[model samples]
Target: MSSLDGTVAAPLSPPRPSSRLPRASDQDGSYPRPQMLRGAWADLDGTWSFRNTGDDPAWRTGFPDARDIVVPFPPESPASGIDEPGFHPVVWYARTITRAELDAAGYGGAAPRLLLHFGAVDHRARVWVDGQFIGEHEGGHTPFTLDVTEALGTDPDTAHTLVVRAEDDPHDVTQPRGKQDWHEHPHAIWYRRTTGIWQTVWLEAVPTASIAGLRWTNVDHATMRLTVRLSGERPAGARVRITARWHEGDEDLATVEAVVPVHAHEVEVVVPVARQQNGQAEDELVWSPETPRLVDAVVSLLPAEGPEPLDAVSSYFGVRTVGVDGGAFLLNGRAYDVRSVLNQGYWPESHLAAPSRQALRREVELIKELGFTAARNHQKIEDPRFLYWADRLGLLVWGEAPGAYAFSPLAVQRLVREWMDAVERDASHPSIVTWVPANESWGVQHVATDPAQQAYARSLADVTRALDPTRPVISNDGWEHTNSDIVTVHDYEGDGARLATTYADDAARTALLGGRGPADRRILVGGAVDEGQPVMLTEFGGVDFQPGAKREDGWGYTSAVDDDDWVARITALYDGVRASAFLAGSCWTQLTDTVQETNGLLNADRTPKVPIERIRAAVTGR
Candidate 1:
């Protein structure tokens, strides 16, 4: 799969779907990626035959004539050849998959399991391999894997067609759709809707009894707890051997062991990689915004005495702990000091999908260069590419969610499922120190409007804690309070100090009413008094954005200021924050401008807008 770094090949819109089912005109044809070719699977992102025609029987076999439908990007993109308005309820795409080399590699050799992986498919999707139903999946942002082994069909396989049918309600409010405007074009808070297959589609072959899943926790320097789940039809009395390799400098440490169990589900095994280096197992150095060192390893599963092992996937880990002590956040067992920003992970070209892997890396680069160690990835859940980059770059991230506005039990279930998957997939990364659910009490507010937003929020926190107690969870981050580990809040214009201290209880406030400074029932610290909690100053410097006409006054995303005045405003805000003892570390509203909101230190194109040296000097108090 081509990593999203830069230089998008543009995008093409798929044919708009009609609510009707199979159409005669379009049944024989679809996108070209469906063709069973020599390379197994080709990049289906370039220009393709496209036609919005309702249906034609000719499509069932092949297209008679068509426009282009870019893979991985929905129809309505400006880059897409067909950028017309209107949402499609259903869309169809057809591609063939056939690997003559792969088919020969297996069968005669042994049992081969061919798996098809879809990085992401918007809404509901159904796949038919060789005209036979293969499988289906639901979810726009995450990934799904289906086994095409059964549908590959028999002997000396000839090239075959694989058709995929998808139905997406870009306007559907039920799914975990993010920031997509249901009616018409996008504005603030909402943007263009992405429909259909918007990510990669690839295939891999695995032997029977292969390693299905892996979970690892970095306990410390020497010892790490690993859970392995093996899959495939196996011999009842089969034995699988597992081995690990850790390479550090000139010294290479390896571990080999055999497991003889009745069945293979999830077995925990411990390995001491750090102890080899003469350090306490628990002393495994931690990775954070400051020191982002990573340890890489390979997990191999083999049969009895076979070296060609069943499966081996490359993985990496970082050493760090995340938690809360006395209502104060801590990283690496110490009271954590944070100066963070909000990262939405958006680009002008791909929208939510990053332009490339290098593009994803650039995100961490910008976050670190901005003089901040951490950032709150607001709403839109990020791609795995982002987490991988964060782990390598040592950028502290607060894994946020794509909050739902409406409260539905189904939606809640999906939220927990998708978020739990995100946690599981990226948990090994040291940069994700925390998980924040229900930002500003969107669904939490309506779900549990009674006294505390705790029920929904706290339940998620408890779940997160149960999964990984090492990290803290900020349930319902905002004015809405919950009995969470950290009392996180976001204040636009008010007593920043008093709000920060509430967690420590050094200062308490009765309430705030859209005003700043001292008020009745004052509990805000920095009121020239004590009795406030150990304030964090989670948010403060939003003082930067471009100012236009009153019609274009959307500074709420970030403080609207002329691009020329951004440096001055940013510097002044940093100075003001450092001057106040009540403010520990303040995460400015943003690190880069996204969409129409231009408040980032860097523009949307990842170009630096201010002098880096000056910003660094201001941050270090030079």
Candidate 2:
């Protein structure tokens, strides 16, 4: 079967679906890590014993009051079956890992290693296997893994007990909480808090020495750089084999093999793509919101004297480049208008945790249905599954880190570490074109004046660039920018005329860019000059309209009386934005109505307030 680009390969079997919208069972029980897929794995996402330990540490031994709760759903959400919205600083979870499950995960091998993986656990997580401490992780949003071969013991008939203790201080202002309200009740922009396990947890079995990490870098139109990181012992005379095939058509792109040097654990290989050769037009295979062409790859670590490989993983990548050229955001060496929406990534039933894997794919479909080319994942590092869907379905994304409320040394340490982790975890995705480390100076509240805070904000951008130079980094998104590739503003002007007047022409735009516009905040600070960076109205058009019932606590930047009124208001706002010659892109206020925020294009149940076509017309200005 041929893909959209008329390419096919053995790995591209079942062919890319022709429909824009995914099937109902598309991602049900699908591999969580689509980028790096292994055949030997187990899905440990069902029922689990849960208990809120409060402030007591005694629950480490055993849960006194245990109840059945759904895995990967926070207790604050109804899907978890422990709908306790109130604060619980510590939570304990217990489950059994049977030998049969290990066997199902292809466990029986010479010197096999059983590995445990957690998608994410809020704040801090400590793990134990049969009363033996395995390891711990600090970041709440990033994934962590541990080799539990010793923890599982040598007994094939044994059923190991796995336990996790997650500690998240609800009132910890220094933590990167994002939209999770520190308050007991949901208020303003903050929503209910997600405590304990909120993402996938699973197990896998591999050889003693395996592929630890894989990074794909698009060097240019034709050249692709592959970085492979090894785990465990670096055996002598081991060679890494990499094979690339066209995702759509049955075509061999590249095949290269490099031997691991003794005492070294990393190797870099260059894969020259056939279609993207210098003579051919690069746009044919380049990835963008319009056409996302991926190259499927199989990487294997082969040992010295054996025909079998020590480890093999399936991965894919797209040939694309993103940068700010002059005053425009360029994708694939061409100017690209970023018509985006603020995606808070919340669901009515699961809070931060997606209700199901299929829901993540549907979210991407819904975003595209609204005629958005991009999504600014506001104040959240969304699940990897969502990013996979975006990559496959051809949607650009702005990766933003959750913000901390206060400024302190600990806050700086926490934000920098977690933000770097978030970037590293998602840097390989072709969909993420930009990195937003700080939003509206959430952690650096005094960045406009305080040199210390300003320095912190600058460091975030600098460090992000250092880690992943492929994408542009926004030091502080919204306003009060210290160092940013794009000048992004957050204007919640209720009047469309006022918004139009504010960014009418060069004089008005220069004045606003030099000084403050809406939100009563500086666009640039710390003696920074506007060097013709691409200007984008990243946040606007938050017109709230509830068709039927409305919550008393629901609020928005502006209110609409009816569906027609809402359509008129948003259409006028989009027109106002389109009138601005200086603005390169615009992101609507939000994609869905979150908790107390009633200014979403869709309702809490993922239903459009008005006809989707009307909203699309308003958004696309067509």
Candidate number with greatest TM-score: 2
Worst 10 residues of 1 by lDDT: 30-39
Give me the candidate number with maximum lDDT.
2
What is the Cα-based lDDT of residue 262 in candidate 1? 26
Worst 10 residues of 2 by lDDT: 12-21
| Regions more than 4 Å wrong, model 1 | 1-66, 79-86, 98-111, 155-157, 220-222, 237-242, 245-262, 273-284, 305-308, 451-454, 494-505, 508-539, 547-564, 579-585, 617-622
lDDT of 2 by residue, 1-622 (tens): 1122334343311211112212211234377777887766788998998888554455554566689999999999999999889998988998888877888677876438888889989999999888788999998888989888787777789887888999999999899989999999987789999988899998877778888888888787667788888888877888776655563454544333333332468888777665566635676678888887777766777777654666777788888888997889998878888999999999989999999888988999999999999999988999998998898888999999999999999999998999988988899899999999999889888999999999889988999999998898888998998889999999989888989999888888799978776778989998788899999999998888787887787888899999889999999999999898888899999999998889999998999999999999998988
Give each model's whole-structure lDDT: 0.57, 0.83
Number of residue pairs clashing in candidate 1, backbone atoms closer than 3 angstroms, sequence gap of 3 or more or interchain: 52
| RMSD versus native structure for model 2 | 4.4
Q: In candidate 2, how many Å is residue 407 off?
A: 0.9
Q: What TM value does model 2 have?
A: 0.94
| Residue 475, candidate 1: C-alpha displacement in angstroms | 1.1
